[model samples]
Target: MSAALIVLILLAVLAIVVVSMTVKIVPQARSGIVERFGKYRTTLSAGLNIVVPFIDKVRYVIDLREQVVSFPPQPVITEDNLVVSIDTVIYFQVTDPVAATYEIANYIQAIEQLTMTTLRNITGGMTLEHALTSRDQINSGLRGELDSATGKWGIRVNRVELKGIDPPPSIIDAMEQQMRAERNKRAAILTAEGERQSAILTAEGDKQSAILTAEGQRQAQILTAQADRQAQILRSQGEAQAIQTVFQAIHDGNPDQKLLSYQYLQMLPKIAEGDNATTWIIPAELTKALGTLGGTIGSIPVDGGGSKTRVDYDASIEDDVAADTAATNEAVQEALDAAKAAENPATTAADLPSQEEPPPPPPAGGTPQA
Candidate 1:
């Protein structure tokens, strides 16, 4: 081949090689860090781009999207000198690809070691209980420290979380017991409160019942008193009606002294029959009643429809005296028999006063001449 033809062929091959080496296509959410002579030159964004063939080279490819990094468990000492194992997860994203490539070597490994050391340091200042309970505080603290430190490395730490914290077996057992005890205590307190409420409700119910019963009794008493008052009013009205009827009957009859004496004598027996009767006093007008009765008997006609013959008043008085004496004797005998039955058997007739006196001897002519 001619020398010119060989030169043209070599030029064509070189051009093709250069073009192939210079062309670069970055993927979505990614960036390429370019370097010249082992020094960072520029960063390439997503899309097609070109670089000086031999001078510029892609040194690092970085992902700009958020990522998760989980670290293995690391042993840490707490404030109480207890060793615990802790694992963590971190969320981060690369903001600047050039800085991420040049600022730090092995950024993921560096961050993991730093996180382990920082976690140990923080946990060293806290007891096991605080370390277990303060996960959010520790995570926030670790995230702040990581974010500040990784700013130059083009890494932004979004969040940090403690995946787990494992304590010693003895501590785990002790915590379980403590939890059980707390649950039991809460249960006991609840039971006691329930019983107290039940007792209070029962007492309240009993009190209400008692109050209602008392009110019912009071109402019943009031009703009984009203009934008694009404009954007494009716009884008084009935007695008044009876007395008015008796008075009207007597007025209608226009009874004489004889009728009056007869009615009084009839009432004496009824009065004596009552259990409350102790003694009865004879009226001072009893002798006048007898004389009136004798006068009425003398005025009474002997023959039916015959003009009244002149009656001897003194004879009638004598006859009345004898009749009264006989009636008194009989009444006294009856009263004596009743008194003997009511009294002790030792009582005799001699204890009583004489009811009859012997009438004055009749006049010698036997005409009841006075």
Candidate 2:
């Protein structure tokens, strides 16, 4: 009975061990490679999988999901012989578990090494500037080459990216300086353009202002000239009216010697008021004119005078006015001539007569006044 109990316990323990080895549980998105006698047999999928406990062994467990690997910065020489450090990130996936297990010993290491070589080759053909700016082109080239080569190892390169490209410190500083210079150049050009436009606008404004000012001045001159011309015309018209009125009064009223002498005396102050008058010339008929004025001064007919006396006085006054008109005109003309001669030294004294000839022979039976 003891031997049977011991045998049963041993058998049960062996069964548990067998069950633990045979039933394999793989997590999601994971694949297990089965090798029988150190040879690849088949790949195991996720969840419960059955295998011969002693004969079958799990050689490798590969994730079927896409994986990302970031590599350290590698120094690469560009076409211009500049050493640049570049870091890369690679995305890969295991498509065939069998090939991945049997083909490459370590797919991750192999992918990383291949990525380094491919990146060097791509960057080697370009300058540092080209390499820095052409990250996308370099990534595409790297991905294509890696996908094609790693496809045989049951690894598909989904993507390749350049995480960072660090140039030499000196080269970075130079590039920064160049960028600053370019910005400064653009700023200077913009500033110059602005100044030029401002100058043009200012000049145009000044030109407009000058033109307007000149036009205003010209118009003012024209208005001034028109006013002067109008004033001159009015003055001439007034002089003509004055002369016409004087001629009419003389013809109708027949002024006497007293009136003629008084008119001559009134004109004396006006003749002396000229701006150019330097010397005064007395007319030769001054004494005769004054004598005629004195004689007629008290003889003016009064209202109480007799009608015969009044008629006789009126007749005498008419005779005297008609007879002295020529002498008065001559005297006035001499005064004007003297004023004109004083203004211009070119006038000869013979061109002016101081007095007229003695009045015509008295009418028949009329006395010739002294």
Candidate 3:
């Protein structure tokens, strides 16, 4: 408690205060603004800064590092008169500490207000749908405006981003409805197209099947007709062969007029066999043959002891045999021609036998004169 000791302690405190005020220790990425008598003098950089103890004072220490600020949601009216809420974020840095300290009372508050005003201006020109989709355009415009306006305040806006844009509930529901309707319309169109294609393909298949069936039927009918023709030809050939064989046997027997007359009589019943043969006429040659036969019978002896006598016929047996042979040949020729005609109708006229004059009609009363 001596006066000298109190004076020394006061001097030590004064020296410490002067040294502390003269040298400023600014953190990394920080700047200090120096003022001379309440007026901006110079800006101090980080680490080991010097200033007059009382003449030059640091008014503010500004952070030079980049900073991020997220603003709260703000209501803005769009061009369509719809109110939407939007929030944004900004990246900024203080480049000039002196200007940041002296040019504006509060740079952060000024930046936030400017951001809101610029966002309203940009969003007011766009519809709700456009505003929701045009986030990049709005962010770019905000960054440009902020960078220009905050230049004097020593703040540089590096980037601006819109965090969220929320449209009205009614608008969201309407958009969902529109999208669902469009998808349903597309599905219906595809279904209709598929059905049309299937119907066309089915019709084409039916037509092809019908055509093939008709072609097969036609081919079958042609084959059946050809087989019938061949059968008829074979039957006619068999009949002709049988007739030729009978005629050949007769010729080989060397039959006389009596035997030929008997054969003719036997054939008369066959000619008159049908029910329509009620009024058949006997030929003149048949009557002559009968007379010769009667004469031969008369020449036979009544008693078994008398000698048998041969009867002479008016016409020779050889002539009758020749006539019969000629008739058999003509019949065979007709049979051959009929078979050929059945096989090929085109050659029928050429193969047919020429016509001959018919015999005279029988006398009245169905009897023949000898």
Best by TM-score: 1
| Residue 222 lDDT (model 1) | 100
The ten-residue window of minimal lDDT in model 1 covers 300-309
Models 1 onward score TM values of 0.67, 0.64, 0.54
| lDDT tens digits, residue span 153-201, model 2 | 9999999989899989999999999999999999999999999999999
Compared with the true structure, model 2 gives a TM-score of 0.64
**Model 3 worst lDDT window (10 residues):** 301-310
Q: List, residue by residue over 1-370, the lDDT tens digit for candidate 1.
A: 9999999999999999999889999999999989899988888999999999999999878999999999999999999999999999999999987778878888899899889988888889999999999998999989999999899998999999999999999999999999999999999999999999999999999999999999999999999998897665555444434443443344344445467567667888998988888887776988786776544432321112111112222342232434544544544453344344535545443443222432344455453211
Clashes of 2: 0
Is candidate 2 or 3 superior in TM-score? 2
Q: Quote the RMSD, in angstroms, for model 3.
A: 15.7
Per-residue accuracy of model 3 over 1-370 as CA lDDT, tens digit each: 9999999999999999999999999889998888899988888888998899989999888999999999999999999998889999999999888788879999989999999999999999999879878888999998999999999998999999999988789977887898899999999999999999999999999999989899988888888887786565555444544565544454344344466567668988998988988898876786776867644432321212111111122433332434545544665674465345445534432233212321243455452211
Give the local distance difference test score of model 2.
0.75
Q: In angstroms, give how far residue 361 of model 2 lies from its true place.
A: 39
The C-alpha stretches of model 3 lying farther than 4 A from their native spots are 1-4, 190-370
Better of 1 and 3 by TM-score: 1
